[model samples]
Target: MLNEEKILAILRLQKCKAVGDILAKKLIVHVGDVVQIFREKTSHLSKINGIGKHVLKHLFTKENITLAQQELRYIQDNAISYSYFLEDKYPQNLQHCVDSPILLFEDGAIDFSNKKIISIVGTRNMSSYGRDFCTKLITDLAPHNPIIVSGFAYGVDICAHKVAVQNNLQTIAVLAHGFEQIYPKVHKKYMQQVNENGGFLTEFWHNEMPLRENFLKRNRIVAGISNATIIIESAEKGGSLVTADIANSYDKDVFAVPGRTTDLYSKGCNNLIKNNSAFLLNSAKEIVNMLNWDLKATPKIIQKQLFLDLNENEQKIHDFLHDKGKQILDVISLECNIPMYKLASILLQMELKGVSKPLPGKMFELI
Candidate 1:
């Protein structure tokens, strides 16, 4: 816990209309302390980059302060737990995201020390194929003990959570609304099990509703808090795709299970795989191999296939990396004469074939 004054100040900053997470962070840093931001002169705060009069107008309002005080009271009374973005206890992966929430309200037994975190997201209209894949994926990955993160909504999200709980893995549900109520009403039954297993996380205040925009905004947390995001199933357009895009933006691995072309719900995932926005996911082994997860038990000794069939572009990129060692994505794109957009998908295909591995700083090397 944070002290009362500091918590109130953080809440006030969150309530400020003009100040988003990124701008709020800048304000806090400029003022040096959360509490001091409230005390600093509006004129002085205006000098900071991105902090204009509009932001100050909302920042110093009496209404926001009152709201903050009420929220602070609710927090104190309910014993609500939270994590500040700057704190060590905050989700490590999410901290790297520039637009991540400045504060996260949490409930239940959430522990991020176990770094094997992966987000599973997909369409609300999950099919039997999607459900089977989600269950089997978690069951297979149980030995590795990865934390399963999802939106905790209907379909794939809830299925992932239930499977994680069944397999005795911690599962975190990133909520769009506040703690006062559960969205979809039907999911309330699983709340106790989730709390006992992993718990719910949200950035919304207690009284906030599960509005359309909140779910979209909440996708960032679902995307950024994990090392990779998996889309079990999706249509041509859905929030899971949005989460995948955000994960890619953060340079995290994204996976999508392939399906028949005629399947309605598989379009988004197929498009993602086809465009190279996500690696084609066949099994949990692919995720383990890509993420380099180490199992406690002796690993299975499956023989590596003698040769991987690579397309012309993949072969070119592969040979380039094979000769020059690890190279940045841009250099590879330029040297191979492939446009960056097309090259990203090609590289992802190469990775899925187990012929290449992505490194930090957008570097790639033949595996």
Candidate 2:
């Protein structure tokens, strides 16, 4: 659970008209703490490279603060669960996305413990061929035990999710709106089942509507949270193509199932492969090979790195890892008294600096 003050600070940033996730992260990193961003003087904050008059005018405004307080109260009273982008609990793969939401509201039990997560998305208007192929792809991949991710919409998104549930695989639904309501209305029937199997995730606040723009924004979460994104079937234009493009931009693997030259739904995917944007997927075996699911999972070992300087947070983490040989993320955050969110970023930076090694399942140690 996120603490009240920190949650409120983050909420305030969210409400700030001029501030978005990327800029909010800049403010927090510059201020050293989320709570401190509000306490900071306007003069000092103005000096940050991205900080400007419009941002200063909107940030900490009375309206924004009041709105943030109201949302904070809602989270507390409802016992809402969420993930801070900087925190260990946030999807590990998504932490690398610069524009990822700073906070996400979560529902039910979504587990990232099984890191084999793949997103399958495509046309809402599905053909029998697409449905059959999607069902088989998921059923075949079930043994590898990947968590399926999708929009929880009609056709392919719903198909991937239902098949995953049938296979008893954990699945995640990235929502375009808040928890208060479900989009397309019909999928509401599957909510309890999804929550039982995995759960739903959204960056939207309570009661926010599913606007057209929201779905486009929601595509990023679906794209970023997964190890790879697969397009089941698509026409010349669609949202799934946008998701595939986003995945490619992140340098993550993207797979497109091929179809006949004359097939209407295959155009977008064929173009993706033809343009070298995605790999031409032949079978589930290829997916398993590409992601190395067939390989055994183990921690990476490296010799102790020497002669590196660390910032205050990095030093604290280094000291903890130096004493504890191979510690999981949660233990280090507690031992170092650093928030899991901030600790995650610091650990990644340390890894890049060659001062630490990261293991599967959020474990870390000195190199």
Candidate 3:
């Protein structure tokens, strides 16, 4: 639980009209603390990059302070649970997102300790085939016990939630509106089950209605909270595609279930696969393999290599892989401070030298 003062400051910054999540984060980083952002002088704050006249003007407005205080009271009176972005309770995957909400309000018993989170989304008018694929996909993934994250909308999102519940897996519903109300109204029936199983997460304030833009804003949360996003079905223009695009932008894995070319709902998914925006999803196994979910069950013990001819960067990578065992290619690049383009060639050179080998799913290990 966040201290009341900290949550109040976050709320104040969040309610600032001109400051978005990115700008809010910038301010926090420059100010060194959320509470200090309010205490700092306007002229001093103006010196920070991205803090413009508009931001300075609305940042500490009395109205926003009043609103934050009211919302803080609402949170206290309602006993609502929330996570600050800087806190451990915030989902780790989401914490890495640059634009993730600074203050996320959560309801229900949500456990993000299990990091294997998958997001499933699609059109509201899901076909029978889409329904079947959605059901079977979550069912097969039950053994993996990944948290199922989805929009709490009609069709694919609801199906994913219900199927996850049936399989005894935790399911999270990212709501576009506040907890005061549920969109589509019909989903209210499933709230208790979802609450008991997983929970609903949102950044909206209490009493906020489900507006069109809110759903678009909510998509980022859905895409950000999971390791991968799977599209069960979608039309040419749909929110599911938007979510997939967001996930891709985040450099997260995206999967699209293919259907007949003529199928209207599959067009968006087909285009995604064709354009290489997403991988061709056949079953849960592809997700499990691509994400290396099953590899965690058995740890690989890599032997430290003896003296070998290697460059400084190559040796750094080799020592890293040797210490960590099998690691994803992106992780290697990040940990070793090598760019992806350079890392690929270096790994290939290492492969030729017989110092390392490539594994399934872009993974590398010391040979």
Candidate 4:
């Protein structure tokens, strides 16, 4: 009963998720009329006023009818979440986007409740300063546990993600294609780590290619998802500026980390700042402090309080290890739900106190 013709007809619509769904629902509503028309009861529905030839042509076609059923089955089985404009879970701020995706495939725990989210974007081909700044910035802001968002591109995006992973924060990559394939296959290992530690999200459906247009289109989602956007380092041209502009259009804050004015990589950021289009951010702490993110956690268990009492930020850290036992840094971040940098420092203090043990692969256990 799958309508292969209908499927092909729908596909011909091109990027028609929302549109096709609407049209399909309409067809269902007129099923009686459609059956009659197909059975020759109405002598060619095209003759009926308001029944356009195009719609009638497709509607009566046996191929389209079969394809329609197939598409319906595919949609139902995939369990894909469509974030239509009317959906309750759809982000309110992103509803007005011109290039907004009609559907999104989400994986992992996504919390839009976080009031403070800043996009850490930069050039794919980054320099030493960009790398060092990103690491230090993310580490410093680990306490606030800002949800890190970025394109899972080469260089800066992955660097930021690596730091975020190391710090134990939730990071989401907005892919240029569907979730079926990952761009820059080299990051497959890192992406797996992201899924376990954070998650990867996308607007394109499964099997979509990482086309150039998709990347440009996906940048808007990156800007839309966050409250602010930051550019670390970019040449005078590249996709980073595109994200910054989208952020501005969305009325979201745009910030740029200043680099040496003379540096080639700094040109895009410098121009953004010079144009007064973006705030000049020197460090992650500034972004954290500016956003007023609530990162400090209140330990509820008696053991946590007792452990805190036993040591200052340092000794109390040992209590986590001694009591909870050894865990990989990533595992601890997830289980403890704490940022990686803070977890590491807390763990380091325990190690120095001789109350904790360090294992291979950056794991720690109680001594």
Per-candidate TM-scores read 0.81, 0.85, 0.82, 0.63
Candidate number that wins on lDDT, 3 or 4 = 3
Best by lDDT: 1
**Per-residue accuracy of model 3 over 132-212 as CA lDDT, tens digit each:** 999989899899999999998999999999999999999999999988988989989999999999999999999899999
lDDT of 1 by residue, 168-226 (tens): 99999999999997988999999999999999999999999999999999999999999
Error of 4 at 141 (Å): 1.2
Candidate 4 has a TM-score of 0.63
Off by over 4 Å in 2: 305-367
Q: Least lDDT summed over 10 consecutive residues: which range in candidate 3?
A: 325-334
Q: Which of 1 and 3 is the better model by TM-score?
A: 3
Residue 279's lDDT within candidate 4 is: 90
Error of 2 at 345 (Å): 18
Candidates in order have lDDT scores of 0.89, 0.87, 0.89, 0.68
lDDT of 2 by residue, 1-367 (tens): 6778888888988878799887887677666678998899999999888899989999968998888888888888998898887677988778767678989899889989998999999999888989999999999999899999999999999999999999999999999998887998998899999999999999998989999999998999999899999999999999999999999877789999999989999998899999998899878999999999999979976566667788998988887777646665655665677765578788889989988888754568777
Cα misplacement distance, residue 125 of candidate 2 (Å): 0.8
At residue 78, what lDDT does model 4 achieve? 76
Which is superior by lDDT, 1 or 2? Answer: 1
